[model samples]
Target chain A: MALSTSSAITLNINGEKHTLPVDHRTTLLDALREHLDLTGTKKGCDQGQCGACTVLIDGRRAVSCLQLAIASEGRVITTIEGVADGERLHPVQQAFLDLDGYQCGYCTPGQICSAIAMIEEHAAGWPSAATADVRPEAGAPPLTADEIRERMSGNLCRCGAYVSIVQAVAQAAEAEAAQTPTTARQFSGPSGPGDLAHPAGTTDAEMTA
Target chain B: MREFGYQRVFDVPGAVARLGADPDARYLGGGTNLVDLMKAGVERPALLIDVRELPLDGIETTDDGGLRIGATVTNSDLAAHPEVRRRYPALAQAVLAGASGQLRNMATVGGNLLQRTRCGYFADLAKPCNKRVPGSGCPAIEGEHHNHAILGASEHCVAIHPSDMGVALAAFDAVISYETADGPGELPLAEFYLPVGDTPHLETALPSGALITGVTLPPTPVAAVSRYRKVRERASYAFAIGSIAAALDVQDGVVREVRLALGAVASRPWRAQEAERVLTGGPASADAFAAAADAELAAAKTLPHNGYKVTLMRNLVVAMLTELTEEAAR
Candidate 1:
């Protein structure tokens, strides 16, 4: 049988399931913006180079412009529109708002989403290019301005609002750390083992087949 | 982007068979590079075999005490792996030095190794690029080519492979494992990337319709003290203008063993065997490091704009090796 070019796939976005028929060529960014009217996820370069289309997929930051709509099924996706807890703004967003983290605000959504995940990744002890020591025992590096700049390098602001962006991210990271001392826990992979696409008990033969 | 079919498989052998049955199919890992190219009209596959769900996202130890990383392992996970950071610090640092946090979260190790060059001519359909078009001629050789290759490049193409992970892998003597219709096969990382003689379009030695399963790093004691240094236009989120991945083992003021690899200097991650040959069993001095670097660049040929790369590469090799030597001493 010839394969169909379109399929009715279900995408779990923002803790909600949306079933729709999408063309195979449609990227997840397009599906969210054009198909589902979730335009909070902006498209800057329409490529992976710019992180304007950044979203949290399986609790990690990823550019949606490069993800195929059909291939992203069965994954939990969170966009900027769903970032708030009903009326409460996320600490990252609140910091950005209070600090004027953006000028034009075109890249703010992406920056916000990216910062949320970036803080988690930093707290998890994942080293960045700015990291001096990569030894696992060295523990998580301090969340300084340089660290925030390196971790959030993907998002570009035409307004050159990087100064305030860095400040906002640093404040947010500090707030999060203060809330939970365990936030800077030693880097274990992702919290839940089941979050990864690969399940445990996979055979070696299959892994290296 | 053009329309294509998507097939996600949980098994490696079945995925290989599905791709083998279709001549124009391409296995999709993270889609960071492939999808971007498809949108740019560079790659137009009829079918995209989604291998992300395959049981190949593992990082395990081999019986020989080496590290084996599954092909579908994301760059973020790979860099964060405790074993990778402690045993092969250069590999972890290389991945972190690559693209941004979002791209790293989406890019797979296999896809990162197979990404095409970032030459403007290759992506611009209006321009002539030998790597994109077999005989279109390399415009980057004359046009804006400050980042072009200086070593192991022909008139056909001057584009450099823009992979930081591949550079570290080359230094550690990585071996690629793939599954084909015929069965399983292994190719050393040295032989994986084909030389850009006349066919810059033909990149890898992997057989047509074969699926890369994983990459294995042979146990190299020197890698434990290795480092990856990249010099780019910016402090972050930029491709390397010149980079080095060097691992050193120094004992009693003598170089016991060393591994050197250069990135953004050639069509592939250049394993600097000449430098290794010169440094092994030699006095562990900064001058010795410079001499080994010079020996490695003896065969380097440069274009008008890319002439700076030769000197840049020499400095990188020296800086990386000298730093690794000191770190090893510490």
Candidate 2:
């Protein structure tokens, strides 16, 4: 028998606070789908092999199934359900639809989440091995097919939507770079699954600062 | 699914305290390797010590003109560091050739170095593997051994270390630093991994209750000319068939100095001492390179199903050294 928890962890999910008594070993994917009923993030492989359980923590995409629920306490988590603004889908989602990036919708949520994070990472001047030049000051190189493949290598799709997924990410990168102002772009800390949280004993205001 | 324990420490002292409290504790960093193994039922530790919150996440230049990469530094951050790519191209290349962007973002330096072997028999508990269970006979000896080691093989174990970063670090004379119950110290890369002589289960030479703190690589002029060549079944996300990390200094077509190491063909990162000896006083040519490869691989003992790895290692050595030679000439 699994032990029940009396202490509840408060998580900021999609801009709302959720307090639930979750098992220590229960994964974030289980917490979201089974506990909170947020089921947009699919679980293809309980292990980290498949990218179907992808979600954005803060702003970076991470494999939710591999992460423990308690490990993500007090962090901002954005699921596929909260990726859009009201009725409009995220830019990556729109790009995926425009490019037919998915044959089966089972992997679409993961693809969109991963693509969104991929573009944000590239725009921040992070370089993958396939990035012809890894210099950060090189400044917005064209997202070629090889570069896209290398950056998106972690997120696998059984449907082989790689070509279209690459296209969607490229389109999203172009659109996102154009929409955001220069001064507003910077990579904050712990954007992925179980990223570093503010140290204990620090007040909420101090953590926000 | 089985239930286990999880504990997250806030600082280095806190982590050490947690480990000190428990004798049989597993350190969790990034959860890229440890968590996977636990889920697969290969590893079941009663206590898990989270070291991600420790103050070891940094990549900086040492006072001695070397690089000190902290244990918690992410693989992606280490590879993407400007000084790393500029000075040690092979290290960057090897890291990039690993799993993928998302994995690199999570895998840490210490975790990658301490990862266990990836033999089919080792992962499958049903199969007999001395590495997984000491004194158990190796089924891979007569079974399907396509991905097993060819160079270093005992009568008991044939698994290969599945880490590209460790191979590259071996080539550059990197040193591993760890803290034990008696305090902290460092050891050369070559002396870190123990051979699978009588006990295939014991992989590293670290004493009980020791934690890897950081890896330091001394500055070398030959670092700027280094390169990593990996020949895998696929273009990405696969283990190497036979990988070579070569660093050479060639001036006017003559070899000045060279360091070479092999992967996927040995129990540990096989440093090509004989190959380095053969290249010391000669011009960079196919003949000299082939002779060097032959000298290093001459003592290789292939298993029943892995004789092809001999040819793979020979070809990789020649091709990698030749490529480094050409680059140095330019």
Candidate 3:
């Protein structure tokens, strides 16, 4: 057996840049878990069938297993690790905990990451298969049960916590809609390219309240 | 996964040149399909030319009133485009029906077009699959073939092209544009896929090192009335058992034009030209629709477990056509 050749690449993970040598065949999921040690993003299925490796690439939800680490250079990648503000939990994470959105907790990271992007997508007036009357005049589609299920169909929980997961997403959406300034401020602070600094000292209790 | 060299091509010429230079090099789009195949050990490319960053992600209107969708356009963007939703509803619906939202966001048009079969035998490394290795013998012909092809399958392979988008593209008579070492050229989507003859390994009509640039859909009024109907075991995230992409243009109780295509029933997207011919200039009635569907599926040669697909395809065609005709009447 011979050692595989490696390539030097810089990956910006969880609001920090790390330069590492990775094999050419290393997927973004492997690079995160094996190389960078960000095990928050679980690998449910090495194939793209399962969404356990879900992450935000340039603010869009993508399956990390399907993305090559070399092809993902220069993009902003937000994992489950980056969803919190210092010691503070993101609203979605708080909602998940408050609602007990997981039983086994294996698929929780992907569910949370996917739900965050799903909320932003709906708020931006994107429609899902469950969305009837997709015209703008129809207004922002409500986060109904059907809408939640359809939008989050990618992330599967074998433990059958789907009902609780949907409830958590709805709660988070409702909280975000309430425009709680402190909670909103954490997410609104510099989440684009070249913005690596995390917000300081926001707490989980403050976000939940 | 086997160790491989990677190259990122910035231009079409560079991509063609690199691919032409290396016989074992495969072009990478979103890696949603190729990576999975590589992991399965079914594909062992020595070099991968990453074409995701190429300047071919645009979705623009052609000068002739058609639409030119770049090959690299993500499935999510293509499905959600306002023009697609308004004009080509079936195409949009077909794309949405195929994959999850996250997968769609990462899958590109080119990658989706070149997606391999979901046949269990083809994906298994230990199994004998002619599609994986020519003349290795196909276990699917007698093995668990419940989801195998019902039409255009030879003795060597019974695999089906698992793309819902391909079926819709076939119905729309879309053209595939490609660039080769010589120059650029285009072929109708109907002529793009090769029949599953003795040589099951040869899938597409693309020349070696030819890079698919985009797909051009000609303007057709039938698009406004089209619908894509897929029947599967589950409500979501399941492959279609049998699907139909139908567009009916009925005027004054007469079917002025109709386009039909079947998915998950053939090795490639089966364009129902015979059905279209039967529906054109015919009465807009359930009887006529059923007759057209029967004519198209008349040649379907089904295996033991997949005999249901023939009936499923017939019902899907009739039901979609009936719905479109009634909508046009209203």
Clashes of each: 0, 0, 0
Error of 1 at B328 (Å): 2.3
**lDDT tens per residue, model 3, A92-192:** 99999999999999999999999998776665555566665443334445677777888899999999999889889888977776664333333311111
Between candidates 1 and 2, the one scoring higher on TM-score is 1
Each prediction's TM-score versus the true structure: 0.95, 0.91, 0.92
Off by over 4 Å in 2: A1-7, A132-141, A181-184, A188-209
Ranking by lDDT: 1, 3, 2
Which of 2 and 3 is ahead in lDDT? 3
lDDT of 2 by residue, B117-223 (tens): 88888878787788888888898888878878877678888888889998899999999998876778788989989988878899898877778899999997797
Off by over 4 Å in 3: A1-4, A132-141, A178-209
lDDT (tens digit, per residue) of candidate 3 on B74-182: 8877876666766788887888788788888889999999999999989999888898889999998888999999889999999999999999999999999999999
- Model 3 earns a TM-score of 0.92
| Model 3 chain B lowest lDDT segment of ten | B77-86
A best-first ranking of the candidates according to their TM-score comes to: 1, 3, 2
Candidate chain B TM-scores, in order: 0.98, 0.97, 0.99
For each candidate, what's the DockQ? 0.49, 0.23, 0.32
Sort by DockQ, top down from the best:
1, 3, 2
